[model samples]
Target chain A: MHMDFSFSYYIGLAGIMVFAISGAIAALEHKEHHHDVFSVFFTGFITAIGGGTLRDITLGNYPVSWVKDENILWAIFLGFLLVIFFPKLLTKLRNELFLFDTLGIGIYTVLGTRIALDHGVNFFASALLGMISAIFGGVIRDTLMNEVPFIFRKEIYATACLAGAILYLILNSFSTNGNMNLVVSASVVVLIRIVAVRYNLGLPKIKIF
Target chain B: MHMDFSFSYYIGLAGIMVFAISGAIAALEHKEHHHDVFSVFFTGFITAIGGGTLRDITLGNYPVSWVKDENILWAIFLGFLLVIFFPKLLTKLRNELFLFDTLGIGIYTVLGTRIALDHGVNFFASALLGMISAIFGGVIRDTLMNEVPFIFRKEIYATACLAGAILYLILNSFSTNGNMNLVVSASVVVLIRIVAVRYNLGLPKIKIF
Candidate 1:
């Protein structure tokens, strides 16, 4: 059995916490007067794990990480409770949301790519898996919240993930150390996303009709 | 490896067709002032396979149902094209939609329950898996359309799937013939759902604070 307190696992737990915070913020935005704790927690938990669950499934990895790892589940609940008690801790909601989402995609993309490679997927498919892992949680969260997925919006969100994932794969092929590859690839995603949001930049719209 | 052609596979393909039609109908409902073919096809295809895909993932079934089965992909496309070319074929949209959805859940619940059992899940989890396979496709469809999932509404929808799933398991425990169990269990789901929708029946509401 793998050690429970691995540094890698802790980093993944931190990513889950970040995603749960964003999910809770969304739930808070869409709260009905009749909403309860279950609704909030379920949304947050699902958002925290949706992407990785999908990635593992796609790669035929068994036991999906959260099922065997109770700490991961705890991290999501902790994140939700943090939001519930200190909503003001996430003041500047829009900016903080963007930051959290960027961190989430950055971390997940690199991690997902590595896992997919370990599962023996081709480089291209692994990169695609990375992008899927990074963005699908938000896609699911928006769907549950009755909104068109944020990924479908006019933003550089998914593109940033795709770029970073591909970059990670390319860097791996260059014999760079794994730590350097992860840091550089994830930072590229974060920097691109930050700049895009700052300048309201996006891909050019096409009139395909 | 499973055969290229099987009675069971054909039945699943038919269910895919039913789900895709409903998804296409929803896409048609929500068409923008300017939208394209890709959007419609994607929405329809996703709806057709969404439930089964999730079911297999949860069971840790490999390659998923649609991924390795080219014919399954073809079935979804056929369903989408049918709707695209002849929207009028599904006139009286409400009744037809109910019929299609009811038929879909009936077929999928039994099949999914059996698949989950084969994957060694306990009885309760198998029943839950059956309901998941029956409902999640529509759940995904509604989400993608930026609506609250239909199953979350006041309805007998998920309950019908659950009852049928439990019935199938009970019958299987009695050493009932496989075909007999499949037919009877699926018919119960269809009959109950049809009656519920006809009479506007739903589970009683509880106001949880």
Candidate 2:
């Protein structure tokens, strides 16, 4: 039990650092496109929390996350500077960044679902919100980068979040313990993501033909 | 007084219609890109309310506009179908659509600013939220279309919103009558948009050369 707690703790901290660094690197990489530093920071920060903000707005949740927390602001600023000054330091951790990403997807999916359900959004909309909460940031980021959003390309990313949300809703209806639902549902998302990556899985494309 | 009320009333109704029809027309215009009807509907609807929804979320305003109003949802559906069945009807109205757009920008900008102020967001952010409320829908739509958001261009659209928001703030601090502030502030946005378009004015581009 203790080991599990510490494992998640490290994942949380390390994941944030990796996420921030990668975002910074992404900003730096696009210098030729003429993004001023402020623009870079804007894209990176939105990529980090845009999904949550979108969810909160749709659900009418107040103050949003970063608005109520100064740490998030400072962390973004620090992440931006960290990448600029120590670009060499990121090479070793590039592979492990998905740990942070997976954790984020899991937490955000369940959290957004819960919030939507609380606000009396229909179960269908709640599930969609969960998926939106997990992926919309990437949607916005990709859009800003002038590319088709990757999730629309038959990737398993949104599908995983959607599945996790459905599972959470099902477990909740059965009157499962709240914490049990949280752990199991989130863990399922994490498992699916890791397994998909390990085995090279993707959703089959549609056939309009 | 009656004349003023009726003008705004017509602007309100016509603006929503024009906004929806133009959005639908935009969807039809992109048929070769292979957007399914559902995708077209999603993009068109989001462009119509995405900005206001963004504002409500940032300010913690509850139950956003569309959720509380079934008319908004019905209007989007009707708009979608209108263009598909009646393509020839929109040509004469194309040039006049800007009237609806300008009214929308003016109303959304000042309305967003007032809400943010009520939520105790800092003045700087309030000004920004006002601009976001005015233009972020287009930003999202453009992002989804994989193009640079037109607002990010040196076009004067966002500039007008930003200016109107600041003007509202200045008036609001003097404890101006709320209705008076609403009228004068929104009019300023409308005036700026009209003048900029009339003269083909644009912000000067930076020269790193």
Candidate 3:
């Protein structure tokens, strides 16, 4: 198994960094809960890596990526530090954070789909894993914070990831260049999420009483 | 790999059924969320099997138990149907439910510890896995329902499981009869939990702002 250390890997790292920041930002919403710094740090770190950890575990990928790569831990630590020192800075950079968060989802969706496919899962299962990888971190974060998962609420978040994964499978079938598939699929996820949020488009909520 | 198809296995299956019922009972609290039947079913199913799935994945135990044994799925399905048809029945049998829930936790704790130890992890790690297996189903259920985890609250739940796991390790060192070890350890967990709840014993809550 020849591992490629290339541009795409860097993008994935950047995605991890952004996801960590988002996790920290989400943790700030629970200030009234009186969470300690370690609590905040753990939430951010888990939020950043939870999805990927589940993905790896399900695919039988041992020594999960974060366990193998200490850089991810460093990135999460940096996120925790930034949140601790400049808590107000996150509120100021909301727009930028949103953009980075969208990008992170896109990058993770493509990466997750590719990894699941590599593990010999069917395309449908791979797409499901891709979406789970993209959104579960936030789900875990919100759950810990005692809030309904934002994706499960009236949001187009997971749908975008699902669409991107399907697009990736389609692209992979047509093209042999892995880089092109990654770029195109990730872009699709980012675009869909951005457009949906901008236009306030959302899935219809089901109410069963 | 000699698998035992005996009383312990039947107890495990019963544990799964009770856990699924507990999950459905929890979901009933989310009536205001207006979740559909599918949502309720998925919640019940995940809560019953989530911990074991995580344990199997971490131990590289392929074809997860529920995935291999369709009986577990049927049990979860039965739980869902019961919840849907007789929502009030759960509330009526609260004491019975509590007893079954405690028993389920004990059974899962022993099963998880044994599996982790079988995978060559250290005793400490195995014990940790044991506690996680006992409590994580409820954690996942609470998270999905958008509430703070009951285990993390002022509850002696996970602590009881941890103590039982330690006792299991100690007994396993001295005894060669696996059945005796299982029964003793699981009984310890059930007794501790019942005593704790009856006496209103709990851990002190930490408030860190």
- Write the number of the candidate with greater DockQ, choosing between 2 and 3: 3
Mind giving the per-residue lDDT tens digits that candidate 3 earns over A2-44? 2467776666776787788777767666766556787778888
Provide chain B's TM-score, model 3.
0.93
What does DockQ come to for candidate 1? 0.15
In model 3, which regions exceed 4 Å deviation? A1-50, A57-103, A120-129, A140-149, A152-156, A159-209, B1-50, B53-100, B119-128, B140-148, B152-209
**Cα lDDT computed for each candidate against the true fold:** 0.79, 0.70, 0.79
**Considering only N, C-alpha and C atoms within 3 Å, which residue pairs clash in candidate 1?**
none
Positional deviation of residue A117's Cα in model 3 after best superposition, in angstroms: 4.6
lDDT of 1 by residue, B110-156 (tens): 99999898888999999999999988988888878777888998579
Q: DockQ (C-alpha) of model 2?
A: 0.17
- Judged by TM-score, which candidate is best? 3
lDDT of 3: 0.79
- Write out the backbone clash pairs for model 3: none
lDDT of 3 at A110: 88
lDDT, candidate 1, residue A167?
95
Every candidate's chain B TM-score: 0.91, 0.86, 0.93
